[model samples]
Structures are given as C-alpha cells and as structure tokens.
Target: MDYPYPKTERQAELIALADALAGPIAARAATVDREGVFPYQNFRELHAAGYLGITIPRTLGGLGADVLEYALAHERIARACGSTALAANMHCSLIGRIDETGMWPAELLERVNRDIVANGALLNSANSEPDLGSPSREGLPSTTAERTPRGWLINGRKRWASLAPALTHMLVLATVVDGDSPPRRGNFLVPASSPGVRVEATWDNLGMRGTASDDVIFTGVEVPRDALVPIDGSATPGDGLGWSAFGGAAVFLGIGQAARDAAVHYALERKPNGMAGPIAELQTIQHRIAAIELDLLQARTLLYTTAEWWVARPAERGANMWRLAAAKYVVTNAVIRATDEALRVAGSAGLALTSPLQRYFRDARTAIGQPPLEDVALTTIGKAALGLSPGGNRDGAANHDAAVPVATVRSV
Candidate 1:
C-alpha cells in the first residue's frame, strides 16, 4: 500500500518528518532489538525534529495535528522500526489523551507541555498489574493512593508499562483511600523522578525489545492532590481508546507490510537449481505475495478509515467504539496471518535471526496480547448486533466536547 494522504498541510509535514526519520530509525532497529534496550537515540532525533509533541495543539506549544495525522505518522514509523514506533506510540497516545482531558490543573498541564516542547519529556500509562492482569476488563488496581497532608502517597507495581525507562510522567491508576466511602478509582499524575519510583529490568521478551516495557514500581510516591485527574469528560474517550487500539493496528500492519516486502525482495533474488530462475517465476510464490497484499490492503483501509471517522464525527464516538475495537481485532489478526504467509514464502531464509522477516514475525505476534483483546472485541460486536448495547457512557455525554482548547492553557 500506497495511501493517498490527506490534502492538509499538517499531514504533509508529518509524512515528511516520518520519511526523514525512517532511515536512521531503520538503521538502528536491529541493534536496539538485539540489545533489548531503550531507543534513546531514536527519541532524541524525534525530539530534535519536533515530533515528540506532534499531537499537542499549536497554541499549547505543539503541532496541533489531529488523531488521523498521528495514526499516519505511526504507520510510517512502524514500517521502518516496529519497536521504536511502539515506544513512540505510547508517548504520543499519552500526550494526546492527557491534552484532550481537561481534568489536569492549568499550571501542571502547561508545565508538561513545556517539557515536551523543549526537552522531549515522554509519558505513558502504567495500568497493567501482575495479579489483576489487564485493567481493561474491570479489575481493581493493586496500586493505592493514600491521602497525605502534603498530597497523596502512591504505592504499587505496574507491569508492562511501555516506555518505562524514559517516561517523564506516569498516569498511574489507583484506588483512592479516604476512610468511609468505597474506594474510588482515579489516576494520579506521578513524575518519574519522584522518590521511590523505580524501574525494574524485566522487559526481556520475544519481541519489541526496544520498548523497554519494564515493570515500574511506585513505593510511597507522593504527588499533589491536584494531580488526581478524573478520566471522564476530560479525555476524548473514543479518540483516546482509538489511539491505543488503532495505533497498535497500524504498527503491526506496518510490520506485516515490511515482512511482505522483504519476502518479495528475497524471492526475486534467490533462484533454485530445479529448472527456472528466481522463485518469482513460480505461481506458488506469486499467489503468496498476492495473498499478503490482499490482507494488508484490507487491514490498512479499515485502520485509516476509522481514524478519519473518529476525527470527523466526534459526537458519535460513543457509538463507534464497538467498530473501532472490531477494527483493531480485524487488522491485527490479518497482520499476524500475513506475516506468517511471508515467512512461509521465504522459507529457511526468513527464519534467520539476522533476517528482518524473523523480527517482523516476532513483533507481529506481540499485538495479539494487547488490550481490547480479540475475544472481548468480538463479544462487543456480537452484543451490538443482538441489540444489547455495549457498556460505557464515557463518550455519550454532550459535555465531552465542552473542554476548553488547551492552546489557551485553560485551567480546570
């Protein structure tokens, strides 16, 4: 695929930035994967190019690009390096969601914007827990926030917190403790350097090694009371959820595309000694390539189209969450299948640890376990079809769009 990018100047600029960064990011991908370390240099380059704040509105010291543009950028970067793109996705997703959410204090939000604009401070949500598993399926957080005269004292361990090694701020989900009423769930904005904030080196995995998604342990971490921001009405619900599901789909799709390209390139160059020349002359190889193309085309179309829809119809976001979740499942499942076919086409050559195809295969597998899981997505769609409405009033209210523009640095 070739996508006819939008006519907007902002989209063009973002595409250009992605094109420029692809080469260096691609060059370092293998090294980053092998070392299982954070892509510090890749991020430094992104900061220099002003992409760290790509989703922040221009008035708030960011480019003011929409969610569609953000998805486009992720697809481009992912084509080059899935690991780096995944890390950037976490940061970009957090920034975009936080900026949209009007819950944060004006002064604190402005401070965050300044850091991202000037120093490229990164952020990501630490929601997953070891015992409770994914928090998406209605589980109480192991993390606890206790009231203190100074502020709130937070304690807990968050597993698989992407970008943990470099995140400047962590949106920590915790059960608020205040004595009487049942503990309420809320998110606390904890600065990464706060005392007792420790990063455990536990990210060694099958793929996406560069994300450094280690376990982040918060012990007696304190933050101002003002930092507890409610997630509803503040964050753009559909867009925020879409960023994770849709953005993830883009990354895996890119990895699948890369795998297809590599397999095709290799098939054209390597010839067997049977009778003909390269395997490209064979019908079997041709059919496999065609299959990969078809899967990718379908996946990309759904991913981008839904992204555009999310931006254009903000009011119906609540209604469309089901479709978006389904889109993620459809696209990611296609990616896994496409990558497997590519590996089959390339045969032994694709299996080498040094081969990019191997990396794509492993990385593509990572998408299967992400939030809004396949079973849940299918269930949601099924429920919708049965006329049983899906749960979630997060985006149903009229006040969702009532947030003041962050460009003006409006206080809550």
Candidate 2:
C-alpha cells in the first residue's frame, strides 16, 4: 500500500522497511498464534533491521524517528502480526518515554540507550499487578522496594508483563519503603537475568497469544541503587499518553485494515454454486465492505491527525488529553466492529481455525479493555467538554499517583 500522507524521505524509507518485513512476519503469524509461542524470531529480525532503536536518539545510534514515524511503522508491522507489533510497541514506548521525559538519570538513560542500540536489548514496564490491577488507578503498587546496604530489594509479582520471555530489563513500579518515611512509588530497572527474578508461564490468552505476557515474579530481587530511575520534580513533563495511545491505535487500525483486505479478497473469490458471480456482487457484502472502509478511514484519520497535532503542538498536549483518549477509543472500537463485519462477510469460513479473519477478530476485541478504556476515555472527554477538571492529570498536574506507565495497556 502506498503511503498517502506527506512524509520526509527518511520517514518514507523507514515505513517501507516496516512494510517489507510485514510479509515475512505475516507468514509466521498463524504458526505463532496456533502454537501460542512468543515471536522471538520476529524480534530478532526487527533488531537486525535496526527497528529496535527506531525511536532512540540519533546520537545514541538510533533512527531517531518521531511519533508520527513510529505510528506509521508500528501500524505496518501490526498489519502483518498483531502480537509482534503489540509486544514490540511496549519496548518502543518505554524507550520513547525515556527520551521524551528525561525521567531517568543521564548515565542510566545513556546506558540503556546504548544497550538497545548495540545489543538489541528490549525493555518494558511491569506496572500491572494481579492484586492492584492497572496502576493507572488510585492505589499504589503493592510491590515493595526496600533500601538495603548494597542496593534495593524488590519483592512483588507483575501480571501481564509483555515480552516477558525475552525482556532484557523490566522497569518495575514499586512502593519504596524507607525507615519512618512515607512510602512512595518508584520505578526500578531490574535486569531480566537478576538472581531472584522469575517468569511464570501463565499467559494463556484468547488473542495476541504470541506476546508471552506472563507473570514476572520478583522474589528478593536486588539491583544497584543507581537502578532506580531518578524522577525529576522540576523537568517539564511529557505526555504519557502520546506514544502508547497513538501506537496502540495504529496497531488495532492495522488489524482492521488487514481484516478489510481479507474480506475484500474473500468476497472477490467466493462464488456460491447458484450465484452468477462472486459474493462481491452482493449488495449486502458491498455495503459491509464500504462500512469497514469508512470506519477504517475515519479511525486512521483521527489517529494520525492526533499524533501529528501532538508532535506539532507539544505545549498543548497535556491540556488536550481528551483528544488522545478519544482517538484511542475510536480506533480500538472501530477495529473491533470492522473485524466483526469482516467475519460476517466470510461466514463460516472465517470461523475456521485456518482463517486469519478469526485471529483478527480476537485480536481486535482484545483492544477494547485496554487502558484509556472506553469508560475512562469517555469520562475524560465528558469532563473536558463540561469545562470541568479532567481528573487524573489530564490538565498536566504533577500527580505521580495518577502517572500511567508507558505501556499501561498490555496488548494481550
């Protein structure tokens, strides 16, 4: 598919690269989903192609792609395999957050960036807990980080840790326990190979099964004091919702696009015994396809336009969080409907295990419950329109309690 939007030459090249990998990745997607296996080979190919460092700084040997570029590439990847794109989005969003926020110490940021550029290391935030649910809510993490003479000892279990099978580092959100002081939440950079860190194979899910989003148990895990990412109280805050919201919307949008294409192809070739021509001749099928195309176009337009607005007007992002939330909500729900329509178009054949439409259906539905969830997004938008305080830091207040992780919504 030709890129319809205007872009720089570098951006076009990067998008083309992503498109080139889509075919090979799609070839393995069915097998990966059928086996419920992590797409390690996909990540290897992505790393080799330097996509792992697409959002990192050029000074750090990365492609230094912006948010729009990231969205386009991610959408292309997701068009082939939702699982690979979703899991990889976690890593990319984390790195992009670090670059945008300067939330970590300079040394720590440099080290992590170098590792990603040189070794193809992957990182993801382990913020969701079984008990706490999503960290975006009011409660603090039950995961505790105790200060020790040597370093910090972490003890907690993180649920829905995407890319757990191959993570190089897990940025764990833990409540810091200090002597006689108020407990505070902090992010701990724990190496995947840490002595006490273990991955529990509990990621049996209905969709995006190749993500390996298992439970990561940190039992007496120890890391150096420097592992604690230094949160600067004075630095200008970056929009936590930008990359994840836009990138996630793109992923689901791609799934919808794939579903639409599959449906069109099926309609063109599926000829009934009594029919004069293919199902494509049916007005009902044509209507459904038209609806799918319309939804996809609207969703894509909103998503990309919001991303461009975000980059072009960084100063207004915090005040316009509702726009971001609306984009995500629209794209996610649009894809779900598109996939359903596509499945209807394919009839029983689409339900067969061999049909990719079923996978697309499942994957698209999975996005419904993701962060910036329907209720949350609607409430935020409603509040904003009412001239009320869009709570949860929608107005850009420094409320760490409502600080959402870069990868708040697990794709699985």
Candidate 3:
C-alpha cells in the first residue's frame, strides 16, 4: 500500500485539534518559559487531547495518526509554545519508535503511557553524553552497560537531556559487554524512580527555558531484562525514524510561521511616521514581508516534500538525516530573520522583555544549536550528497573514544 504522509482529512483534523489545544495555553506556556519552569499543566492538557500517544498503535488507546499528520500537529504545537512543543515532540517521537518495536513491556508501556496521558509523564531519550556528544552514530558509548547476574548495570552521564524534569521514563542507550561478537549497543527503559538514576534539573539555557533540559546521572542503575527495548532486529518503517524526521521539520515550520504571524500582526498595528500610513503599508516593510513569505513557502515545501519522499519509498528515506537538518536550519534561520526584521520594523519597543518578539528571538536562536546543529548538519549533508563517507561528525574523536576499546580494558 502507498504511504500517505498527510492525507487532507488527517491534516484538517490535526489543525483543528492543535488550534484548540494550543490556542488558550499559548500565553500560559510562554509564561512558563519566562519563569524558567516546566509547562506541566499545558502538556497534561495536550495529553488529554490525545497528543501524547497520537502516533501509537490504536490498540494502545492512541490516535495512531500518520507521519505527515503527526508533523502537522507538531508544527501547531510549536507555534504556540516552543518549549512545550519541543518537549512533547521528543516523547511523541520516542513512543512512536517504541510502538514500532511491538515488544511493548506490557505493564511498563501501559504505566508510561498512562502517566503521559493522565499524569503528564514525559518520556525522553538519553543519547548525548557529556564526554562524547550525540551517540546516534557508530561512536563507542562511554556509558557502559555491564552485564551482571542481575540484569544490566548502567553507569553514565547524559547531558542536554531535554524535558528531564517532567520525564517519568527514559530510554537510555548504552553499550553492552559480551563474550561474543562485539559489545552490543542498545536502549533500555529506565523509570525515574529506578535506583541510581537522578536528574540534575539545572538547565539554565538562553532559550527554551521551559524545556527544563538538564543533566541526568546514572549510578549503578539496574534494569531487568524486560526493561530493555531491543532495537537490534527491529526492521519496520517506524523503526527507522520515519515519523521523527518529519515531526521535527513540522515543529520548526510552526516556529517559523509563528514569527511570520507576529510580523504580520505588528505591521498593521505599529504605525511609524511614514509617508502615508502604517509601517505595514510602507513599501520597505511590504518588500521584507514578501521575502518572509517566500522563505516560509520554500521551507514548508522542503519539509512537506521530504515527508512525501519518505512515504513513497520509506526504505530509501535516508535523505532525511540531512534534509530534515536542512529544513530545521532553513526554518529557524528564516524565523530568526523574520523576528529580527519585525523587531527592526517595530523599533525600540520590540526589544523589550514585555514583547513576545524578544522572547521568540531568544527561543529561535536555541534551536540552531540543538541536536541538528547547522554546521555539523551541512557538513554531513555535503559529504552524503557528494558520495563521500561521513564516518562521524565533529565529534569523531569523542565517538572514537566511546566506541573503541581502551587499553585499560583487557579482553574478558
């Protein structure tokens, strides 16, 4: 069967749902950002609206929306509150991947989803390490999963773990010691209450403060065999991050549109001492606004087109590793420019803390440095398009340390 990324009907329904869920809480969620706190209640509301596990299986009491529809929903969420949207986006992607595994730890999955739906249980992935950056590549994990008679003993430090404060369960990716082939890398579901796992709750970032991204420490935390969500043999479309790529692009699209909306609104309202009327009516403002529209259109097209590609040939959708990066790069850069232009048009008042534009400017800047950092992304993308091998990113040396065997570690 052909994969429909975003059937029209699904889009319409998602848009309506997002409007209702995010509209009223937009202001409140932004306030949470200002207060440097988590948007707990806002996410609870979103969960109640079925946004928590919207991409999960229908048998699991979820919406089970398609990939494109999922992205559309994320965009709407982002437009309202960047932090809330980003936090929820992480969980949605994680759950979607877990659902693909189909080895849902019956009681664990239900409890986790229940917390997300009713108790605002946010789930996140602990992939980035303080010593070795992001570990999605072939990097050796410094975080070891030592084999013990009592399941697996994990001990590692994860940095820049977004949404940790609100997260009840986290999938920690680590390397396992074995007597056979090579040390196997896998992910395990760790509950917050699990012994030896604690959150630092000390993220004081410049943007997206409401994300509550903090350092998570694991000290001899033990997970039973059942807690491990093995990805070794998983070969489904969902297993390959099909929905996550599209979802990230969609959220960024929302952020870009939010800036666009602000600019438009400010144009009509702010009346400069121009030749005839309001600043929006001025030729200069009109021209810049038109450029913004072009940026938005182009970026949106890139995202939607990428989604379409994924749906058509899900297996050949590897381009997303870089394309999604580009989409995020373009959208954030576009929105940042749009926000700056809007501020310039608004003059002094736009820089004030009381103004939403100022907040957006700060928030948008944060996205640039996040996971798909523009610099690394473009480099990796260039290598891929040119048929060159991108063994690893800037963190190659660090990844080497994580994946390679140290001299001190003798063969067991």
Write the residue-wise lDDT of candidate 2 on 1-412 in tens digits. Answer: 3246646787688889999889899999999899989998899899989999988989888988888888988899998999999999989977887787776778878899999988989999888887886576646898999999988999998988999979999989899987888998888889999999999999988999999999999999989988888432424434445777787788899999999999999999999999999999999999999999988988988888888888888766555667778898899888999999999999999999999999999999889767877887887777766546442444544233333223253434
Q: Which sequence of candidate numbers ranks them by lDDT, best first?
A: 2, 1, 3
lDDT of 3 by residue, 9-93 (tens): 7677876898898887687866877788888788778877878878776776778776777887788888898888777777887
Q: Against the true structure, whose lDDT is highest?
A: 2
**Clash number for every model?**
2, 0, 2
**lDDT score at residue 298, model 1, on the 0-100 scale:** 88
List TM-scores for all candidates, in order: 0.92, 0.93, 0.84
Task: Give the C-alpha lDDT of model 1.
Answer: 0.79
The reply for model 1, stretches above 4 Å from the true place, is 234-239, 391-412
Candidate with top TM-score is 2
Worst 10-residue lDDT window for candidate 2 reads 398-407
C-alpha RMSD between model 1 and the true structure: 5.1
Candidate 2 overall lDDT versus native: 0.83
Error of 1 at 288 (Å): 0.8
Best-to-worst TM-score order: 2, 1, 3
